[model samples]
Target: MFYDHADQQAEAMHPNPDWTTTPITPELIRGALDLETTQHGVLPHRLPARARAQCTDPQLAMVESQPSGVRLLFRTRATTVELDTLPTKRTYQGAPPRPDGVYDLLVDGRLTGQATVTGGNTVTIDMTTGTAEHQPGPPGTLSFTDLPDGIKDIEIWLPHNETTELIALRTDAPVAPMTDRGRKVWLHHGSSISHGSDAASPTNTWPALAAALGGVELINLGLAGSALLDPFTARAIRDTPADLISLKLGINLVNLDLMRLRAFTPAVHGFLDTIREGHPTTPLLVVSPILCPIHEDTPGPGAFDFSALAVGALRFRATGDPAERATGKLTLGVIREELSRIVRQRSADDPHLHYLDGRDLYGERDFAELPLPDELHPDAATHRRIGERFAELAFTTGGPFTGHNA
Candidate 1:
């Protein structure tokens, strides 16, 4: 049962005396590379300090702190759990408002309950101009009651799209960090699609769902609008420990119009080279962009569909001309071809390196059935489809991330 945060005053005035308060610490957090002590609370960060220091873009900073796959993991017998959090929500200036981010609770790996904190902060964005305004507010408490009995592992999956700061944790029973389960740690990097974009909840994100099905611990480095093959991100991935690794490249590169084929090929090569320095023989998969029709033949620097925006809906359209491909501009088609060629060339010497065309996960036929709502990010159902497909292709027998190989 979800205890609504509407009773914020009551919760604050009459704290449950039977509950035990637990301090938020690095040990209790999973999927976050670093935890920063903020004035309000400990904030989980997806990127390490070094990588964050290299970039000055406010968007990257905001997304990294959104904690796409980060969760609080502990073993407990608590039937009631309450978490105090300050969630920074986002709103588009003229587009339809987004719902508050969700917190998914899992007991023994099964999703048990879901809740959302009522109020905290809001970041209003002007999509057309690329500007944002922040409004700070007070924290809210999320409570979950009537949990199943007996000692079990519990995971409080944080909001994937909200910048949440942990303020406090209270439970009826004691809690301890969950011990390693011997599952292979799968580290993945991609664009916002992998960052849980448009997904209903944190655990529902494609990477999260895939990790659950594959029985692998996930460390998602899927930064929204920031997966441009940055050297710092590559270095972060290289230094992180993982039994298997995958990089889903292309979409963000095209949408951002960050580089041409000339710059992209060498950057991709350099990114792989950096990762190989640390994980020389680990099963590494290179995935190209999924089926995005707008950028299939047309180059990008994608723009908002202003017509849709007029109706209070958010949508995107490729703005660059297709003829630009003649000048070595990148289109999804160009990326897919080049990625395949690069992987095939490198695999001759690097037996562990592998490739999967992203279209195989969400292809033209799939797109026809479940078209992308925004011409880019997949919707919740699409996230599930992509996740299931990834597990089947990468974790089953004869796959690069098969038990024997990973």
Candidate 2:
């Protein structure tokens, strides 16, 4: 459905008398309908103001890795149609200024054109008028001409910038589909570790890397300080669709000292129950946390050891009573044991459910060889190592990944 700049111009000049009177039909709509697309941003949940400020690159500012193409659904009332692209999320310093120039245009998910703005003007394409203009302030609109005699879908690729905000999207069509069936989605939830806490590029995050490695789609639900078995998050997971799913647990639970054994057990169960509502038969993997010496077997009033920072290490201490430790209170090691037990119990009845000890992703041996930078999140090298190990363990056919046996 993409029109070249010249084609758009020619169509604009012709002024078909039937253009506005063309009949509309659903057959022309070409992308996914009733779907919601979201970005994990640079980090997971809880986007801090400072982190938002650092997203200066237009491409990296908003959503990353848009599916190759999407269908633009539209309705026709007049001789021509105009399309606009805007940012959905914004970072604030003071007042919002005009967006910068630079953008690509796509029709039916294919690159059909490009545009450059001057000052903060919007880019407009008028097919019937056979003219495209860059209007100052806000996003400009694109007009399409030469009525195809039905509803249509068009997609626009906007420049990425920290300041770019998705204000509005309009089309002559009645509906738009954002994704296609070819995209395989993998929904994942974990701690800040899964959120790209210390990863390098927006795309280099472990989930992104793993998705590339596995050649599948991804929906990362990792939250920063808020992975504490919240019902709302679990409900969000339950409502989303996925081809595969994973929950990296333990470390956050231990670090934050959210719950003890009794509560943690049922909390895990409820979380699984919620996800099962949406993905009843999809493959689901539950993982424990990687090794952190201070939180391994200890309970916590976890504190940042300033001395360790000087030496490029972090020391966390368990504040639980020694007696509590004996009884197996909240510690990474304890959480791992409980997670294993829970998975075993659940898997007996749910064939698609499985468990992966977080240690399998990164263990004592791996840590000893390359310790974490601040005793918490892994460094770039570790992210690569973890990503590789995850791909090997979870994605490879005939590997340890459950159901591959069949």
lDDT digits (tens) for residues 284-321 of candidate 1: 99999899999999998988999999998889999999
Model 2 lDDT per residue over 70-129, tens place: 223343332245333332322222223323333444444334554533223344433234
After superposing all C-alphas onto the true structure, candidate 1 shows an RMSD in angstroms of: 1.3
**Cα lDDT of all candidates, in order?**
0.92, 0.56
Alpha-carbon RMSD, candidate 2 = 12.5
Show where candidate 1 strays beyond 4 Å.
9-14, 404-406
lDDT of 1: 0.92
